[model samples]
Target: MGCATPWCLATLVAIALALRSGYAVSGLVLVSGYYFPTARTDFWLTSAPAMPLLGDLMRYTSPPIISWAIMPKLMRTLFAPRAIPPEFKNEFPISLALRPKQLRAAAEESAFLIPAAAQLRLQYRVSGVQLGSCMERLTGSSRPTSRRLHAVLPSSLLHLVEDAGHMVTYADAAGIADAVAALAPSAPVRTA
Candidate 1:
């Protein structure tokens, strides 16, 4: 986590500079869970009638859809950590620990989920790693969302493998250099 902070901070700084310089930012969002908005639903509804209605409709409609459309994946995300064999954990550097307290917190706290969801959504606009990697790191397991994200994310986007199973980190020096070089404008060549 400590090693990855600088990389995350640097990316944010780069993004701010890019936006300030008038470069358009766009991206895809891939997450295992929903990201609720910061503002109250009533406030949002007053400004845009469609917002609250959509959310309310989703709340009512999503149950069936989630059961049929989302449950399999969600189950995989919940259970994958347990499937990791004891031998495998011994062999690999990674260790999966179940902390029900943290899981409960994540389930209840919008703050924990919102940023991750936002990051996934933003990935489509700016090249980034698949969301699964980030989730895996956070949950200490390889989630189906991570696999789905890899399949869904376009090939052009960059993938940063971080400590968290589904978290993306930009600590790869070569990758960072390459990205910077690619984004940096080429100097005009002068004929000798």
Candidate 2:
């Protein structure tokens, strides 16, 4: 629970924060790619291309239909008076996504400060999948690559799980558990 796996582009900001802050974070388990604070081209070139028919196919599920299916459970959850933190309660996840320039600024600031804190840091590991065969990766003209990851996290351990995709946890939970155990021997691994 204490460790964090900042998924996708979220790793860009999270890593910057961890490096900039003086706190000795337990670890960062990066899932998928670690986005670098580079130009928009760097990101766009790697993303999947959108096709018209596929786009329509992806969005074909009606919102009302989805609401009808899940609204009752959602309402039940919302009705519960949970002591959630203010940040969690009020925060919109989309608001956290940073533009390339914003990401660059954070990276520059972090790069300057990281040297001072580098010696005091703890474990930082990365894990990616063998195949991200979902529509997004499948549609992309070029194969998905973590070309920038090495430059960003040169010292961190990297793990590639076989037969996994963007939804790595669902594809291979046991592999993830094994990776965690390998990273931190004391970490508990629950099997169902």
CA lDDT of each prediction against the hidden true structure: 0.34, 0.37
Write candidate 1's Cα lDDT for 1-192 as tens digits: 111122333333343443343554332222222322233332322222123455445434533344356544643443343343345435532111113332222223322233544554454345432212212234443234334434555453424334333223212335434544454345454799
lDDT of 2 by residue, 1-192 (tens): 001123433544445555554754445555554243322332221121122454233233442244346644543342222233355345624223233333333334334332322332232233222111111111122233343343345555555544343434444456556655555656565799
**How far does residue 121 in candidate 1 sit from its true spot (Å)?**
3.8
Provide TM-scores for the models: 0.27, 0.36
Predicted structure 2, TM vs. truth:
0.36
Q: After best superposition, candidate 2 residue 107: deviation in angstroms?
A: 22
Runs with alpha carbons beyond 4 Å of true place in candidate 1: 1-112, 115-147, 158-171, 185-192
- In model 1, what lDDT does residue 20 have? 46
Model 1 per-residue lDDT at 136: 20
Model 2 clash pairs?
A: none
